[model samples]
Target: MEGYGPAEIEKLLPAFRAGEAGEAKPPTPEQDLLGGPATTPENYTLQLSQAQAASPVHQDATHAPPFLIMHGTGDTMVPETQSVALHSQLVHLGRQSTLILIEGFGHGFLNPGNVTELGPGVRLDNGRLEREPHTGFTAQQSPENPFELEGLAADHEMIKQFFNLHLG
Candidate 1:
């Protein structure tokens, strides 16, 4: 539901419609949000700008909901710069917004649970991810490793608190 529109959605639709297996995973750049390596620089910029325009970045203070952006620092698929832009724009527009860049985390690492655990197939040799006992989520970091924000209980708590404060 988050970005990864059209092309990605098409891939998911058949799987849901048939209630069966879906297309195999595409390359990360194609499968992830804003991962468009559009054929050319002009094309990429145009597509990206168009997509960004459709996001909260285009919304003025009068036209957007409160934003709480949580992103991982080590995400290779979608970079945090996108969120940073949105948050910066929101703040500049005098809108209520928050951006939390979870260190030792990567793109779409947000998970809600009591503990954060590395999912299967996480390559330990990469040194990008480490498990957290307290939260059971991967929250550790190495100076040379990338980060991914696993959906962790602590993340969930933050989400809950945000909702309570905003929706209460």
Candidate 2:
């Protein structure tokens, strides 16, 4: 995660996760990949400024609506702790908010489960053709399956119930 740029990060995506590498590899400077070239104080300031500008300003908690926050524990782009921090802040301000953490998932949870073919063929968001991973189950190893869909579905349902209780 530390030694990844936008391009390198893109390659780790689902579409490229299984694709064969091309002959020509793009040149990525070591400094660019690591925390050397873009880790200047000015870069940090710019990032902070951008985040502040993009963040929503909180209103008075007394009039705010209930909130449901879902965070993926394996999210490398944005740490799951950020959601926890926000949830804690809302609770501290006497607002109704619930945060659900989905384990073993990265930023993309729209498609869940072990890697499998979609059908005859299909194209992914990143333009590579492939099937998404199966939802609610892990992959089998040594002719033995370790994935449990029922448990994952139950956890997903619990999150739904929590949202319904607070938001409905």
Candidate 3:
């Protein structure tokens, strides 16, 4: 209740208390090893609290080491703002930090078979993002527009350079 908002605490407190009292059902054999649905109030609160505890944004960053943060502008899984916030925090604390946003790419772009789809607000062409409020598309890699493939190679080189500069 202390860590959560009034509305969320109202919903979660009942379930959390029920779970503490052993009113929640144990996992059945048919259920996955990870347990029940993610939306379950007890599990949701636990997971959210754990994630918050582990989040770097909430940690003390004073005198932290240099950082090279990279994120995809089109990523759907993790918001790019997290990287921006971390970088800003590091810079504000007087630590060296660089933030790079890869345009027209989604989460796991370095991995194979991950399709990059632009949302309605933007469009992707030749690894570049274009402003097209009504247009959205899936990226296609060709000889002329080998965005993801070239991006992976470039990212590897950038990582190598960062390590050489920071750790060498």
lDDT of each: 0.45, 0.40, 0.45
* Candidate 1 per-residue lDDT over residues 13-45, each given as its tens digit: 111122122335443433245443344445555
Model 3 regions lying over 4 Å from their true place:
1-46, 112-154
Each model's total of backbone clashes? 20, 2, 0
Task: Please give the TM-score that candidate 1 achieves against the real structure.
Answer: 0.50
How do the residues 54-112 of candidate 3 rate in per-residue lDDT, one tens digit apiece?
55766787967666665566664455666666666666677666666666455554443
Error of 3 at 50 (Å): 2.2
Stretches of candidate 2 exceeding 4 Å from the true structure: 1-47, 56-62, 111-156, 166-168
Candidate 2 lDDT, tens digit per residue, 1-168? 010012222222222212233323332322223332233455544544443343333334465555555555555654565566555656666666555554545553444455434233321122111132322322111122222224434244544554555557
Cand. 3 Cα-lDDT: 0.45
Between candidates 2 and 3, the one scoring higher on TM-score is 3
> Where is model 3 poorest over a 10-residue stretch in terms of lDDT?
1-10
Candidate order, lDDT descending:
3, 1, 2
Residue range with the least summed lDDT across 10 consecutive positions in model 1: 1-10
